[model samples]
Target: MKPDPSLAQRNLFLLHHFHNDVAKALHEHMREQRRRGEIPPYRVEPTPSGLPTLVKINESQRIVLHTRPSPLAPMQAIAQELSRQPPGATLIFSCGLGYLPCALAPLLNRMKVIVLETDYDILLEALRMNDWGAIMPSGNLLLLAGKNAMEEANILISKHGSLLKNGIRFFPGRILLDEETPTFTSLQTIARESQEIFNYRITSNLQVKKGSYAIVAGHAHKELLSVLCEEAGHVNMDARPVLRRPAVTQFVQTPEMWWESLGRPLPAKLLTFTNKAFLPSEWDKMKAFGIRRFLWCYDDPFRATVDDTFFHHLDRIYCFDPFLTKRLQKQSPIPVHFLPEATAFSEGAVGPPPWDIPSTLPVTFVGSTGLQRQDDRLPRLVSSRDPSYLTIRQFVLDALAKDERIHYDELMALPVEFPNFHKSARVVLLEDLATFVVRLHFLAALVNTPAKIFGDQAWLEPALVGDISRIYAGRNLDYLRQTPWVYQNSKININIFNVQCVNAPTVRIFDVMACGGFLLTEYRPFTEELFRIGVELDVFHSHEELREKVIYYLEQEEQRERIARAGQERVMREHRFRHRLPLIFAAE
Candidate 1:
């Protein structure tokens, strides 16, 4: 009455199918056999550098893999089987389609596999269809959800109901069974009973439900990882390693060197919020010991600064201009401040008016000419198609091309010209723009000349105006002192623009007068409030008036020198950074 030995072996395999012992034994045996040279090794070892160590095989037939039925290595063996499969042949899976993907990964792309989803476990059925897309390349795999099982799988439809496609027919009634059994048990019992009695084939649709529940289709990778992890039953199966941290925190060298160069005048400390847009090598060292404010510049309006928890630790949020200031004020978790920009001042004054004709005739301007409308040289747009003239754009383009980081180069290139003035006469230059000259205090030194330029255009275009000059790509301040215009003219000038009425006197005018240059500038209503027109500085209304004043000033040498001297004295006395620096440093 004893059972046949072959039948007993088959029963044992069936009973131990979900236990995964067969898979573990097969994996260990294969490794040992390969080491002993009993079988050729088919797998590659991983590298220390995290790169894969691939196995080199010239022909597909050379591949041999250990495949045994186990819950732990289900996908591994299935994938191995897929590699050896021939195209267009269908491999019928007795288990749910879910198990087919991991086991047949290698064949998924090249050969056909038809999955028969028996009505076994609802969770297994749900899990199997999750990563069905990975099997898509193996276009040979078809999922058949048998007719009667379709209604039973409706529970899946309810949870992920929206993913259902059109034309699918539902089964009639639910299984009526003992309530004491586990859900999976009841499902399997029903499945085996139906297969034996009615010869029913159980399976459910593998197509993802569209529209409302379609999110599942896109999450195939995540679901596949989850399934692999669950099937492995590995409490500590970590495929990816944690990122390594350096043993030492590196410190930069520049700030310390700069501090040493600056001597004791270095404030108790310094802070700089910077962008890669500027040279960080010099700034990086300075940031190590002193306070470092890191403000990453970005043009994307939708960037979320709040998610950057690191920004809140900085003291002052330094930006290149007020526009950046305004943008940061809304989202920045720190106080924002503007840093004054630097310019090289040409050495010496234009000298006094001559006895006969003046030496420096018509003033010259330097800078680039761009699209007529989009340049600050031509401020007004003649047509609707014109874009605003902004020096920042030029600065960005030049910086990108040259990989240089010094700021205000575009402003340094302003076009300064004596439009209608006599060649021998003195003329004032104006350079000041709201967003362009973020800090205007540096303009204090250029005020000593008889004929100085004023207004936003002067600072915005100092090179052309003769206020500040530099040799191409030179970083030395001495380049400004070397320019010819520094010694040829009667005096320099200063003035603010109308757009800057809301703010105080622009910095260029202040710097000009402070530098002992002559001052001749615009006639703003606030000009008189700050200084006497004839005594401290000369102001003109129209272009014609500016021409006439230049001529008159050249004739009246003493009067021009007295006014220039007085303006320089007043600016140095009251308008220096020492007097107004406190208001700027206060916490807003």
Candidate 2:
């Protein structure tokens, strides 16, 4: 068999960008088939539209990849099918000849599309028939080829868990192989199960609104926002439906039931922390009920499977990270604004406990050590054995370890190129790994110092390497009540920003300042934009600087008091949750 230049180029491209094991397996299988003088299972055919199509040749039967003359005919059907479904991730059982993904590329802006093929031979034939360079690098399309449907499904869940959100839709390719029947069936089952779980979780958090504004968020945000809204004379309602009820029972009163329970006049607006608060259908119902939907993303949107489709339901989006805000503005039709996290405390909010100068800790840090559950996330990248991912990970870890001040945007925009390295979930994983490294590097220096770490037993792990157990405080702190007390009483509160939060100070900065505590925080590009560097809140550029600041501030009690007072004033005047409400509702 002669080596076709086009097919060889395509195979090489696949090997460069995709999983090496799958590409190598296809190469060896094709070589063995050629040696046996066996014809390829699929052959390319010219369509009347001057486009190539695929035709599968079995023992005595011919199966066309598409029945219509134009290769795009199947795409029309797919588009029509998609029009009826709600916005979310898509799961295709098979790739067929790769035309589906290729044709759907323009429509898949930020949407996650997973292609699972049971037969590697068919996948190999598809790779040989088409050029996947454009679609492959977009990072939205994932191709998984495995021995069986169950195996592929497991891989999909393990690697791309974010895509399994509530509204995921499953589709069998137009030309499904006999071997792919089980794949299609099993994947549909998985999708159904995922939807059920999502429905339960969303419905479990459903509340009936008493105020003109409804907030759907995690426990902390929900409590904070509820208080803020009510304090502003909104009389916010706590719409708890039922407590500790089974999911089976919760479904009896569907999300629509709660929405209808809001009575004839619905809330003036609905504010949700993330897209996970409601189902696609529920979003539609809310939109139909004339309730404006606004989303505030605390996490980096790029780190999750959220895409443009998810934004279609939202009227406005406020992102905590500036880098992501800019990225989302370009990709989403909705208005994307930069809104940093704010302190929940108001101007005259009372502290949980009276501030005691004598009992105050010298230095305190409140947050997770990111090291916990670190191993669970590494398996996906490690198992792939992709040198590109490994190289990028090591490069980032080394760069961050050398200089903790290296900006996340700099790492992301590094000039060094690797084929399709940035076009996968590995980049997100790299962000997490970089954060852990920077956090460990800075926190380890505080081992001998008087800095006491709170939250997560991971600090006591071997990574910190000291009598960290003595410094490790309780696992949890009441965010609304106790956290403010800790921040208020501490002499110097330390804040370490996650790398993924490129140019923004985290909620901890605002919280500590709101509590009138002197803060020594890691520097961020936008730190100056938010506060006076030395007057309001101090920032440290290195571990040595952090330690020096800790010692210096501990001794200069008057200086600490001045800075703490300034920070508290700045936060109460401009960085409270009440201040954010106007900016959020202004879009209306």
Whole-model Cα lDDT of every candidate shown, in order: 0.35, 0.65
* Candidate 1 lDDT score relative to the true structure: 0.35
The prediction achieving the highest TM-score against the true structure is 2
Write candidate 2's Cα lDDT for 474-501 as tens digits: 3446577678778888889999877777
Model 2 clashing-pair count? 1
Q: Per-residue alpha-carbon lDDT of model 1 for 513-551, expressed as tens digits?
A: 665656666455557777888888877654445556666
List all candidate RMSDs to the true structure. Answer: 30.6, 16.0
Residue 111 lDDT (model 1): 50
- Model 2's TM-score against the true structure: 0.56
| Angstrom error at residue 192, model 1 | 80
User: Which 10 consecutive positions of candidate 1 have the poorest summed lDDT?
Assistant: 241-250
